[model samples]
Target: MDTSIFTDKTIVPEDQDLIRELKETSVLWYAIRNHVHGLYPDAMDEWHYSGVKYGWSFRIKDKKRVIVYLLPREGFFKTAFVFGQKATDVVMESTIAPSIKELLKSAKVYAEGRGIRIDILDSSLVDDVKQLIEVKLKN
Candidate 1:
């Protein structure tokens, strides 16, 4: 998995607490996947975000799915930059936003604890993904 984006910077694995946060992110991500279809029945394929540590954007069934790209950027740890699919009118007012909100909340807490700042790419409109991202970041 050519992790060139992450290799440009150094990440100390010795941060046990950050390690724990990564583990937790994995677990919560799994749960989010399981709930994807139910949340957004029209989600689509997964797309990787550039210039992020672990940034990836994908669709569950049709709606967009966004996750934290835990990578170090210019000496700052960046997290939760929205890289998911665009949100459509159908998805903007749907339950997908709330569901994604919950997922991001967990991710934000985990990333923030590790001294990371979260941001959203906001390229997807099918899921109001940008708004979801901003909500989490602001909160």
Candidate 2:
């Protein structure tokens, strides 16, 4: 079986260096995939963001709605989730990790919702990220 990522742009697929970059992150990405895909098997989509400087957004979509945005980093990845007032209350009430709660507390509030970004270094944080996903899906 051939496991490779084909980019949205022909320009991207043609670049061997870009393919290698994707390959380098494959292990970590697979760790992420194991957790996310287990819960949201159908949420997978080729929803790559355009002109990303650092890495890509691995979005889990439910029809037209976006559940979460997983941004890949050098040796880690960041999960972006937006929570409304009610969801914020839920997060505050939940027994998530202190660091994650601190992140929630400091997250910038916008008109739409409070945007929370969490960086995950290893598979250990997958459960927390999933909880955040539950918060995102709640609303």
Off by over 4 Å in 2: 1-28, 52-55
lDDT of 1 by residue, 93-138 (tens): 4565464544444443332231223432222222343343333332
Give the whole-model CA lDDT for all candidates, comma-separated.
0.36, 0.64
Steric overlap count per candidate: 21, 0
Per-residue lDDT of model 2, residues 1-139, tens digit only: 1112333433333224433554544455555556566667777654464543333356777766677866654445567787888988888899888888888788888988888777666667677777777776666
TM-scores, one per candidate: 0.29, 0.71
Off by over 4 Å in 1: 1-21, 52-139
Report the poorest 10 consecutive residues by lDDT, candidate 2: 1-10
Error of 2 at 56 (Å): 3.4
